[model samples]
Target chain A: MPFAPALHSEWLKIRTLPSLAAGPAAVVLVTAAFTALAGLDESAGADSDPLFASLFGVVLGQIAAVTFGAQAVSAEFRGGALRLSLSAVPHRGRWFAAKALAVGASALAAGLLAGCASLAVGWAVPGSRAGGPNWGEGLRGVVGCGVYMALMALFAAGLTALLRSGVMTLSILVPFLLVVSFVIGGVSGTAADYLPDKAGQVVLHSTSDGALGPWTGLAVTAVWAAAALAAGAWSVRRRDA
Target chain B: MTSIDVRDLTKEYGGRRAVDRLTFSVRPGRVTGFLGPNGAGKSTTMRLVLGLDRPTSGTATIGGRPCAALDEPLREVGALLDTGAAHGSRTARDHLRVLAATHRIPGRRVDEVLEEAGLAAVSRNRVRTYSLGMRQRLGIAAALLGDPRVVLLDEPSNGLDPEGIVWIRELLRRLAREGRTVLVSSHLMNETASFADHLVVLGRGRLLADTPVREFVHARAEPRVRVRTPDGAALRDLLARHGYESVAEEGEGAGDRWTVRHARVDDIGRLASGAGVTVLELAAEERTLEQAYLDLTAAEAEFTAMSPSRAQEA
Candidate 1:
């Protein structure tokens, strides 16, 4: 509660950057676009799982989300603004907490909107009822997707803190998510299930026969998010701004 | 009283001592200029005082409490260390609003600062569109947003035009007159010469001098008397005989002019009149702040000798 001012300041900072809006916009647009494209494939059938098909947009949307999160902190260091921020708020720990809360909350809200829209568009297509698409399940999926996006943002923040460079954070995270995770999935079935993206995808499965149950998959993604955030918090408090 | 007291503060960057045994007090109601050359540790000292950098030894306190202990730091001490600190994509008004939010300051204060900094016309423009001088003004506006008791600005005139420089000098004087402690750092002595009332001079992580600006300038003053006479040779000999040191001119117009050095204006006048040399024009030349600064730091062997000691320790 006492950090409300700091949080408010961080929110204002995050919202004003064009990248913040542009990045989230990409998430929503890509989610809708991908769902629309998937909907056109008649052979894919309308009876296929609509939530999973629509949720595929996150594959691209997460990239923009991660970029926004990483730059939230990295841009300050790059522009030599961290010194000014630290001078205004001497307590590094409190500043870090406020930044995390602001960035994470924004990413979550954007992710939820993108997820729900994508699912609705995909399910609206003719004969696309893979499951009941119950409102409760749909709500849970949307909320879980939002949580997943927030966790990924936190993960990016942590990586940026550890590396202290925008390019380096992206270089490592992008390849790990896009290429390495896929490669591992192809080589070993079960091992790939624990990769962040793979674990996060568990929330999209409406049936019971997925690699991980919905809650179990969220817990797996949460582990990665927690570890990254913990590492970020420690480094932010210890290292010179 | 609102003041910054740095006591025996020390900062070590790995093996190098960036600031050592630094002790000084900056009091309110005056502009205290922190003067030092590049890498002389002026910024490091400020960072330590603001609690941005952890000191290796000792402590710095604001109003008898450490800067870290302040519940609302912006209200207590406002600092403008970097001009490009705000996100470039944000509008000038938004940037100030964010900083103001940290102190629960009203949105109207943001507009007030925008007007004060002469940024009202461009408040809606993104910071990336601002020139370096505009950015510097924005930074100052942010520092003043809280109406703090103490204001710290590092190299505030680094990128200002002549008019902007004059504006900053007047603004600082007005702030100090209002009973706020204003600490400004600059490598150029001439920049702070007329504006600063007190000075804390540093060289190579050591305090070289801490005194009133006028006294510092006066004590190091080498007032000279420039004399132009029809018979320059006669005037030189006359001044030499009167215990005044004269340096000969070396050009086409050099034959009729000579510079006689003396600390006292009266002595130079008496010597010129007593020697029967027609004084074409007699004026006591006051040393510029740059000249005085050179004289003050020229004799400082501690900084020059630091490299060898550091090499030995390594």
Candidate 2:
């Protein structure tokens, strides 16, 4: 009845559902594989930020994070599962909080693991023109990778709640990340940097060109996630299951 | 024991009232059947009671508090809204465990319900692999996970085989015997008549009848008397003199048999005896629950089919 048991219940749901459970593991695999491949590229110039290059796989790996968050909430909408869930918990706010916490914690754990794996493989790549990142840069990238992925996952989760459909959430987000974000970066100036993904990915860079520094960029993304979650919670409370 | 009390509960979807201003109470120690024609607001009422959907006005409470206000709902009430309530990817055991964890129910209790619902043999299988009947059993298993005092089910017999139907009937009876408040919704009149002691009939989002099963059948369905006589003309003449009319029933001996409404079997028998008319068969034909339900819900149905003759003409 208290928040702890509800959180435990949500965690159990994630563990049992194969699609949701695959999220964290996929984040690690995708990010590490891409980061290693990027490190092996000979076209990389000396001017390239090795830290960002090592963590480049995160750009693709974040899809898994988004999916993980989306699937966790979307599954409830399918097959009348939300009614069953609400019948058991009754308090919509508590259930949503528990769900968000479970998703955020699992994504954070996976992101941290992926960050370490990506950094290790990137630094060990042979014949790499890009030099190794300094100790401070390495720590920053690893921490940033974990926090950034978790925030992205939560962001997707909040949007999924508001939309109440994973397919719709993915349709809007996947293209925005794959196509729209880069297009904005090429044309739009400082305003484009404030986009949720763009702002959050700044932490993965060794140096940021945007108005926000690394922490400030992450903070901006956090605000986006918070606002999305607030909308999601409001939708859950106001709408019928 | 906790009872479900719904008071003036109204819910409207897109300006269409799904549940009108309705009120009813389900007492403990008995099974109350929630019956209705399609789109009759039975499921909507259940959803409102469980707080899955917000009501436009009024309240539905379990025990003395609204379901949302209960700190530990699972420990107080359990409901099976549909067979598809569980995710297909999770195993039956895991699904129950997830729900069980909400109230800190013991792991052993999950297995206990699985065994009770006759799903233990395949409890480890994913729900996607289950048959409709199996999914139904799994839903029942989830409802029993918390061992709550109040249980609600909506069309629980939808995909059940005869054996499963029998199993559910026994289960509902047992739950009632344990002094739990059990409310099950279904359009199957005979099935509900078999187990439920009280009935709450709904039509077009409005309450139609709320009474005992026997009373509903007796009060709503017109009773008829069948009379067989050797001298049909004499019996008919005697009945006509007494301000009674009879219709001949089609059968092996059409003219010899007659069915009379609004006339008691004993009255006809007395008249036949006094007039020297031999009565071969004289008995009151009680209507089946199905017939009674059809008669009551016929006008209230949303989609009534054209009569066979009218369809043929068209």
Top candidate on lDDT is 2
Indicate the residue-level lDDT of B120 in model 1: 98
Per-residue lDDT for A1-241 in model 1, tens only?
A: 2688889888888877787757667767776667667666667755455467667677777887788788887877855577767666667888888988988898898889888887788777663555536777678778877888888887898778777877898999888878887677554347678877778877875654556877888888889877877888788777766
User: Compared with the true structure, what per-residue lDDT tens digits does model 2 show for residues A124-154?
Assistant: 8884444677789889888889999989899
**TM-score between model 2 and native:** 0.94
In model 2, what is the error at residue B31, expressed in angstroms? 1.1
Q: What are the per-residue Cα lDDT tens digits for candidate 1 across B1-314?
A: 79999999999998788898999999999999999878889989988888877899999999999987788888889888878787788899988887887778999988998899899999999999988999999999988998889999999998888888999999999999999999999987788997999999987788988999888887887888776677777877777777878886653552466677754667766776877767676667877777777787886754465768654743
| Residue A175 miss distance in model 2 (angstroms) | 0.7
Fnat score for model 1: 0.67
> Which digits, one per residue and each the tens of the lDDT, describe model 2 over residues B237-266?
888899887887765753488898778778
Q: Which residue runs does candidate 2 get wrong by more than 4 Å?
A: A186-189, B253-255, B298-314
lDDT of every predicted structure (CA atoms): 0.81, 0.88
Every model's Cα RMSD, please? 2.6, 3.9
* Global lDDT of model 2: 0.88
Residue B91 deviation, candidate 2, in Å? 0.7
Reference-based lDDT, residue A194, model 2: 92
